[model samples]
Target: MTIKWEALLQVFGATLLVTVLVVTLFVIGIRALSDEKKGPAYASFAGCVAVVLYGLSLIVF
Candidate 1:
């Protein structure tokens, strides 16, 4: 059986990219939580939640 190298590479690259994006967003949310400002912190948390939900939808759909 022939290996589809290109498809394998594409999946690997996509997974890596998504992993980085989600982790970065989570970190941002955590940092915002520690900050004194309330408005930006809430916004950051919302953004983090949105990204996570979107990622889940991507996996399910």
Candidate 2:
């Protein structure tokens, strides 16, 4: 069987991008909480959850 390098690279890039985005959002949320910024902290946590749910939906559906 032949491997599709292009497709593999595309998947790798997408995974890396998503991983960074999620981690960044989580970190921002933590920082916001520590700084006593409730609004931004909630928003950041929500963003992280949304991304995770989207990823799960992509895999499931």
Best by lDDT: 2
Q: Where does model 1 exceed 4 Å of error?
A: none
lDDT of 1 at 29: 68
- The ten-residue window of minimal lDDT in model 1 covers 36-45
Instruction: Give candidate 2's TM-score.
Output: 0.97
Please tell me which predicted candidate would have the highest TM-score against the true structure.
2
Q: How well is each residue in 1-61 modelled by candidate 1, as lDDT tens digits?
A: 9999999999999889878877776677677778766677777777767877897998899
Q: What TM-score against the true fold does each predicted structure earn? A: 0.69, 0.97
Model 2 ranges off by over 4 Å = none
lDDT (0-100) at residue 4 of candidate 1?
100
lDDT of each: 0.80, 0.97
